[model samples]
Target: MLAEADNGAELAASMAELKAYLRIESDGEDAVLAGLLRSAAALCEQFVGQWLIRRGARETVPADGRWHRLAARPVVAIGAVAAVDDAGAVTPLPVEAYAIDIDASGDGWVRAVRPGNRLAVEYQAGMATDLNGVAEPLRQGIMRLAAEHFVARGDEGAAPPAVVSALWRPWRRMRLS
Candidate 1:
């Protein structure tokens, strides 16, 4: 399971940023705008198939006798790996036990020299955690989407704007399966 270190207390866009982007002069809708910003960020993450915010994740994967791909994208760091026995005893594996690998799109994997019944991996993954970490194009894309959402006022369906897709297209991960 993936769990954010901050429990998602930080957002890609701040309340002030959203307010400025949406051109809101009144504070009455600040709460609503904040929620909308979060919703837009989440939708953008889903659309792009990567985390836009820094999130810590712990995953327990069944060893398949080879490399194991991580569930999340843009893996920033691998914290630890451990072996879980049938009795649920966890043994922390040494750093040399596995080799970390990442693709161009930031998809990460671990090649374990000795495969076990279960392997637990702790990692951090995301494209960014704050506005500064986000690229200008992506930031603009988020703003546009949030603006669209705000204008639509929850009346529109789940479909995202074309601009959002275009901005995030380059960063999206491609599956070769």
Candidate 2:
């Protein structure tokens, strides 16, 4: 399961910023701009392979006496860890019952002291809790990408400009196969 925290005000502020960047002084295109911003943010997150906005996530993995990596990166906190039975019963585990680790690159892992059938790990992950807290390059990339989209609204086949990727490449997470 996954859920994002409330960031409406921050999102509104970002949309306002985008409008200002585009020199749009009227609300005439607010709806279209909002959609473009959301699309830009989604694309940016996809390129970076991490949630740019803070959110809650629950990942279930086998508790086979081995370390299991969590899907989300830059984990802000682990809220809980629990064991689940075949019957769907959940038993909360104490903090001491498991070990949590976050590497320098922000990858997270958890291992249970005693093996079980499966475990559920709940956590918060992201680079920022709100748009204003996001890294400046990322924030600028979102605006620039949105502006590009706005300009190319009717050009359905046009790909995003290379600048967006240039701005976000440094933060992209690589996965070893």
Candidate 3:
């Protein structure tokens, strides 16, 4: 099992970082609300990584691969430099990454946002299937994390699937370039 303190700290830190980023990144939008969505997305990433680790994953190697936050946004850091391939002797899985796209409404959506400079490189995976599989569970996980944060901060109202789904509908249909 994941150490509650460690996972909890990661969750808290990711949420705080996301809120800060949105406050700075949001252009004339409600920074508070945008921050909330960002926080939710970041928390979900943390949850995915922490859950995998808690399940006794030995490595998130390429071929096997791993999704992690090297920097910014969703801050779930998983795996190690060993996943990197030195040459054809080993092919490294380009690190998978996470992104959440929230519509102007409060619905949450997600995508892979792994970074790279080479135009040819891509982190290909069964994103649609992964999304479908994770959607409901992640919503619940976000609700759990949000509940924890809200209680600690004395905030009100946990996000519901109905509200999240409604807000997310638009972003869920969004296409990436």
lDDT of each: 0.76, 0.84, 0.34
Better of 1 and 2 by lDDT: 2
- How should the candidates be ordered by TM-score, best one leading? 2, 1, 3
RMSD (CA, Å), candidate 1 to true, equals 2.3
lDDT of the structure predicted as candidate 2:
0.84
Instruction: Give one digit per residue, the lDDT tens place, for model 1 in 1-177.
Output: 555564235763377777887788899997777677777777777777888878889887776568878988889888888887899888898877767777776888876677767888899998777755887777777778877878887575756688888987877666677
| Reference-based TM-score of each model | 0.85, 0.91, 0.26
Off by over 4 Å in 1: 5-7, 154-159
Leading candidate by TM-score: 2
RMSD of 2: 1.8
Q: What's the lDDT for residue 51 in model 2?
A: 81
Evaluated at residue 106, the lDDT of candidate 2 is 78
Clashing pairs in 3: 60-65, 61-65, 62-93, 107-167, 107-168
What is the per-residue lDDT of model 3 for residues 1-177, given as tens digits with 9 covering 90 to 100? 111212232233334434453344544534434345446655455433322112112222222222321211122323322222444342333334434333332222333354432111222111122222335555444544444443455445544435444433432422224
